[model samples]
Target: MKLLMTTAVSALVVLGSTAAMADIKLGASLSASGPAAFLGDPEAKTIEMMVDQINEAGGINGEKIDLVLYDDGGDPNKARTFATRLVEDDEVVAIIGGSTTGTTMSILSVAEDAEVPFISLAGAIQIIDPVRRWVFKTPHTDRMACEKIFSDMQQKGITKIGMISGTDGFGASMQAQCKDVAPKYAIEILADETYGPQDADMTPQLTKIRNTDGVQAILNPGFGQGPAIVTRNKAQLGIDLPLYESHGVASDGFIKLAGAAAAEGVRLPGTALLVAAILPDSDPQKPVVTAYKAAYEAKYGETVSTFGGYAHDAVDLMTNAMKTGGSDPAAIRDALEATQGYVGTTGIYSFSPEDHLGLDLSAFKMLEIRDGGWTLID
Candidate 1:
């Protein structure tokens, strides 16, 4: 955790390059040791690990990548400062970071002003929905997560559902998206509730949900400990309604935060990496997914989440763009837009100018907790 609070600047050189085209400078800003540490810690580790792997395999057309990384500590002000440093001082060609929605939004203007290609790891749709010319992201949009959850609810013939969300920027954004997209799937939002991110308990909200009529299921969309708190409260209240969580709680920390028994049978939208051990051998994503799982678990001694995989995809996508098109930021942006059929741990990515977050609804793996561990749902 020493690396989380400080900014470490180091060079990762692998091959020789001509004077005209020297090493490409890339940068990242992750929240390695703050409230969102669960998301940022693994992401920073993946980026560091992949850089070594890529450099060892002949370093992007014989030119090494000079990756300058910093930990924002989950602070928006720090994110803005680091974004500016990477572009103006370090003159990095591209940046990949801002681990949370709040932090990512803080740095958006800075990346745009410098015209450097930015691939954020934030979850909100507002990060790229307007389609900023120099910005792209790897995580599935909140809108997509909402649609994925609602579509599944419709299939089970469960139309009436209760909803709970945090008051934070990420939660509010996803809450609005869910409200707007629910009618399209013929799902009704029967009971609506909310709580703050730092709130310790959610029994009051669950009590409201328990008294609501025709509430066949419950949907809670928020990251951090919020969703886990809801799970604990629901179990304590003896509410038997099926609980659905957002992709936010896809990490093992959530399972630990809420006791295993309380999280049992709870369903959530996740990526293939969560069930990498059970994926079919013929699956194309299995190769990359399994490799990521093994490397991350071996190095960090912890389970890998889709949030970390998002950072992996961002690093590889930039590497591919530079290898094919060159180091120019514009060319990298164009190549990212042209990415098609790229097998990532999350899913197959296919980006276009109009669509920054490429994967479709199929990218999300429906998962349920059985016993005390993650169980893949067919």
Candidate 2:
């Protein structure tokens, strides 16, 4: 009877300890390798670092976070599989990833069906335009990027332009959005061209744009190495018109890949984080962006990209929501939706029932590439 009582007491103590140490599970799916690795790699690093920081700072409500992260390798099918595993097998309370638009869309279905709070890091308007109940995103949409670019072009009196886009999901979506809204900004896309994601050369497509009638400038809407290749091809062809790229390739890697001579004079839309150092003292976002830039560069030893900023914002949004919502998925979703005036590396976020992506055109800053570095134009 004494032995049995001792065993029972030990078992009860173990159970109590297990209950006391229960973790809040969070899941993420990213393309940390393959073609889109540049975007996903930094994003994965930021998420891991942020989770570690949170746990080190006593975690949320005294519960440590159990992060379940997967590398989708830029494949949508793989993203779907991982998202399903996160929902059904891992049973995570919330998710905060999707490194690209394709992967984000793939994970969106699972998140919606499972009713899990998901904060995506992709830059596609479609991800949040229809506004699924459980889905939100951190990056400024490609449409906003388009509008921002056109707004700059209008100021420069550039009315007609040529476009060369990649065949990838993000490239195709932004291409459509740019075309659809070109008229609103009084800009006409006179020449349209395209390239495959794996194509090494884009001279032929750019040559056609260079020779097109009334083409005042060129816009390349794509991610990965395609835009860098396009920049090189344009330089080789000596196409001197102003070149505008999407926010997709807003990284120093792009400039390095394209070569300094080729990438010079290139303009694009980017977040304040890219120009954090130059921001004035009174700017509200200056402190937030500078802190993030400093921390990210210090830890990773690489120049911080806007892609990493997206991950930073997503983690912050999720963790802030978790503060009030605890471990309940529905309550977390509500808390995320109610987010307001949250300053982040990307922009000031304020979510609502109608708008899942809580950013305006003001969130984007027009940037020019000069001497192998980013220069703020606006």
Candidate 3:
């Protein structure tokens, strides 16, 4: 009888320890390989960095976070499959990442059906638009990006432009958004061109644009190497028109791939993280942005990308929600929706029931590449 009682006591202690040591599971899907590697690679590193920091800081409510990350290789099918596994098998409380717009869109149904709170790092509006009850996104939307660029164009009195976009889902979506919003800015699109994501050269498209009438600027909306291709070809073709790239190519990788001469004088809308050091002292975001840059650079020994900060914001959002929500999927969703005035590397985030992406047009800084670095176009 005494042995039986002792056994029960030992079992109780084991159970207690197990319960005390329980960790918060967060799942992520990033395209660490393939076409969108520039986006996903930084994102994956940022997520891991934030996770390590949080854990080192004694974690949230004494529960350390365990991130289950998968590389989707920029493939929609892989994103879908892993998203299913995250919800059904790993059973993460809240999920983050889907490296690009196309990959993120692929997992929306999986997250929605599973009733998990999904925070995508992609830069498309559709992920959160129409407000899927469980969906939220971290970056400025394609629509917001378009408005930011168009507003800048109006300020410069650039009334006409050429447009080239890849056939990828991200490119197509931005193409539609830019076209829809251009008229509102009183800027007319003069030439519309399309190219495949894998197409090696874009000289033909730039040639067509250079010959188009009244094309004051070139707006190319695409991600990965595609925009770099356009930039390189445009310079080679001696297309003297101002080149405006989408926020999709907001990484140093694009600049490196395109080379200094080709990428020089290129402009794009970006989160202030790219120019964190240049931000004025009074800017509210300077503190966090600078800290992130220092920490990221120290750890990775490479430049920080705005794409990385998308995942950083995701970690902050998840940890914030968990502070009040207690790791329950439903509670996290409610807490996430209630997020307000939380500043991170991307911008100030204040999510509401109607708007999942909290950033406005002000979140984008007009950035130009000069001397192989990003320069703030003040």
Candidate that scores best on lDDT: 2
Which whole-number lDDT from 0 to 100 does residue 218 have in model 1?
95
Where in model 2 is the C-alpha error above 4 Å?
1-21
TM-scores of all models?
0.91, 0.90, 0.89
- Reference-based lDDT, each prediction: 0.87, 0.91, 0.89
For candidate 2, lDDT tens digit of each residue in 25-86? 99999999987788899999999998999999999999899888999999999999999988
Which residue pairs show collisions in model 3? none
lDDT of 1 by residue, 122-164 (tens): 8888888798988888999888889988887888899999999
> Model 3: per-residue lDDT, tens digit, 228-253?
99998988888788899998888778
Ten contiguous residues minimizing lDDT sum, candidate 3: 13-22
For model 3 the TM-score comes to: 0.89
C-alpha positional error of residue 101 in candidate 2 after TM-score superposition, expressed in Å: 2.6
Candidate 1: 10-residue stretch with minimal lDDT: 10-19
Which residue pairs clash within candidate 1?
none
lDDT of 3: 0.89
Residue 312, candidate 1: alpha-carbon lDDT = 90
